[model samples]
Target: MTFAPLDPVRLTADLIRCPSVTPAEGGALVLLQSVLKGAGFDCQRVDRNGIPNLFARWGEKGAAKTFGFNGHTDVVPVGDAAAWTHDPFGAEIVDGWLWGRGATDMKSGVAAFVAAAVDFVTQTPPDGAVILTITGDEEGAGRDGTRAILDWMEAQGEAMSVCLVGEPTCPDTLGDMMKIGRRGSMTGYFTAEGVQGHSAYPHRAKNPLHALVALLDRLTEWPLDGGTAHFDASTLQITTIDCGNPANNVIPARASATVNIRFNDAHTGNSLSDWLATHAEAVETETGVKIGLRCEISGESFVTPPGDFVALVADAVQAETGRRPDLSTSGGTSDARFVKNHCPVVEFGLVGRTMHQVDERVELAQIAALKAVYGRILARYFA
Candidate 1:
């Protein structure tokens, strides 16, 4: 028996209409669950801490050669709704482009893969398994989205041999690049405290702002490294610094700053945190101001070395688009960082030039082509 092929463009439109903004289900998961469940997938609504996620599999619980696809249904907020050419949630198609918030950043990617997987299993069931882990918290704090599903998978003894994440990886065009790894991401918050006093008094009070500036200068003055083979040089960017003193003549009691680090494979979050602490301590000791440091790690750097798996994805992309995709590690972190702990994972999808922007959109042809590429990957993986 043969089932009708899934229509990714239409599915993408349906998803966009739901307005599943970050941390909200918005019926996006419900639409996906209904479709997957009807196509013989074991669907589960893995909700955690008020966030919605969906896990669906077509095979045994612990298949040895399971192929997984990860993506997010939730999208970033659509700022300045009136500034949009098309309704942010309308999912309207104009001039062969789909316009919406998640069009490229990536409700379209998810729709393509889900369509491909559903059609593949219905028409040519793979010898192994196919799992889809879709989360709703990727655009938000992300504490209980994919991580929650991973925890549930562990408790249930479910696993994947290799996974692919459908996050708009293409930089300029479809099939132009694929991510084999990602740089680690961490952020540091700094607080420096001192006594408040009149600015006219020379030595009456310590100025915390001066100490904060010195520490920030120390952190950014030196390069983290030359560069890694798969990544560029690590970077520490001072995102913000503030001294909340209203009076012009007052030396504020407290000054604060924040720095975000995108580090390569050479350092872990802990190592960088220690590095930050050392500099912070020095500033405090020299200036007689108390320094407080708080660090949060979004993800650690990870790479899936070039081999059979990388070649498999590359071959599929080249076969469909005739473009030899670059195996890159340059990008902001994704849920793949969490999945890396469970299985070797990579990311590929549509062009991301307009993701999270005011007029976010995706090319109609690329959406169809993305589905074809995903279909090819599934066919070869099972063969």
Candidate 2:
């Protein structure tokens, strides 16, 4: 039997009930597809390399401007379920808060946008188009999620005028802060190789540990960049160092360390990797040791400069909440980075205080307020 259409509160709870942990459908996409289809959206379940994603659009044919809502259906694994006051999948409401995994990290935002879409279709059928690009692989490697969908969209010649990612951007209150940009992230692994020898026989063998330490010192000795107007100063942090040698008298033949860099628009993954390679080579030459460097980038930094869409969203928030929102570029990487390639993307959502926590939750009032904000943005955008 078909369930009755759910409001934002019930919709959020319904989504949380699905347990769509990373790389798992968990029936979340099915539920979303059913709702969108019921609302007259042309729903297509796009699969890439065995990953589940959905693309739904509704409007008159030959529409010029398309406004899209993008989000992920995946939630981070609920660590230690017993630690939760309630079931992480229970979607319980107490003290005016709906509690569950993904409540704020994003199911709430998805529900808010879904409710907004429902409202939009009910009141005024779009003169253009309203689309959704929802993926189930966001919390994982992200190889087959938004990026793949974007490639598909590009091939189909579909263009979006503006896209909104509901990634829990608010720092203090709803609509208080909006993410206008994000820093890029890259991880590097370095290995220094040397001849194994007795620790006491210092004159006979090369010591890779010394070379590794010296290389790391050089890597972190200076900031990656000064703070940009829209982003903070870049930083490099060594997350791990390992030699795995237990013998007190034997020197390790090899040592490895992992470093992560959070950089601004001034750097890309290739550029940073080249920099590290050059530095590591310099150390290799000076110390007469072989050094290997490996790098992987999750995403590149991006900024949505002040534009028509940014102003439109900011104005909508102020008009609805009577408070001017701050435009921010502070956050980890999100699906917006992919959406940015297709159109202007901005992220504003529920307060992130409880996202990914044991008792993740959002206030009922805030859900309504977020819906209002989205509705206002829709009204303004379509105006």
Candidate 3:
């Protein structure tokens, strides 16, 4: 069968035209499904809880070897449309660059891999299968995005031996970096309750604000760890502190603060929760003030470690670009965190200097280069 080679840049431009904000289908997945289905791939609408997700497969299911690609079409809200020189949803090509919201955050990445997969299957027709898990909720709460697709795949006995997430992994250049793992992300919410009274009468009131500030100090002043081989030291950032009391002369009865932790393989979500709780308990014992703590773990730190699959991707990256890509876990959490649970997952793609920022764009050449790299990966993976 002869099929026209799908141009990734044109596909990316088409996707950028879709207004698929988080939690909205916005025709992005629809366009992909049409493209994939037209190319003899099996497609399914894996929408869950009203969040749109698409799952596509070529070749036999549960084959001896199945390579998968995961990406998201949903983009963060375009802030201040007037601040931009081009339409946020318009896939305008200016000076060898394609501009739009999802262009970098990852509509282009998706287009690259989709074009590669379609062309790979049509031309070479590998013995194994190819699966794509594209979600519409990566920029949102992420509850019903790839997680939901994985759940459905499990129930139906579908699986991918290894997955590559097409998130923007490079920092400065297209082939500079790739993620072998990501720091675990979790948020801790702390509330301190004490007696409320006038600020002038210090002895009459227990100030929760003071206790909360002191607790924050203990968490931030110290380092979580020196550093790991593939990961840096864990970081705890205080995102916010809230005390509703508006009166200048009153001590609030309750004050709360939130801290987020990006931890390394040295720790798990549970361990960090325990760490936060221990500090709150010590502060309570010392200050004689009641403290409440709650923690939510978005993802736990994980690494694929340098091995066979890692080499395949790194080799492909180096083959395309003259430089060897660094295998470092320096970014925030990604859908790869969830894919890690199912299979050996790695992240690789475009440079992400402007992701989620106004006038998000991708270099036209990088999009073409990324497709070639992915094409190389597929050829090597199924060789």
Per candidate, the number of residue pairs that clash is: 0, 0, 0
**Prediction 1 global C-alpha lDDT:** 0.95
Segments of candidate 1 deviating more than 4 angstroms: none
Report every candidate's CA lDDT: 0.95, 0.88, 0.95
Which is better, 1 or 2, measured by lDDT? 1
Clashing pairs in 3: none
Error of 1 at 174 (Å): 0.5
Write down the lDDT that model 3 would get. 0.95
lDDT of 2 at 130: 88
Local accuracy of candidate 2 as per-residue lDDT tens digits, 72-126: 8899999999999989999999989898999997888888888898778767766
Off by over 4 Å in 3: none
lDDT score for residue 18 of model 3: 95
> What is the C-alpha lDDT profile of model 3 across 15-122, one tens digit per residue?
999999888899999999999999999999999999999999999989989999999999999999999879998899999999999999899999999999999999
Superposing every Cα of model 1 onto the true structure, what RMSD results?
0.8
Cα TM-score per model: 0.99, 0.97, 0.99
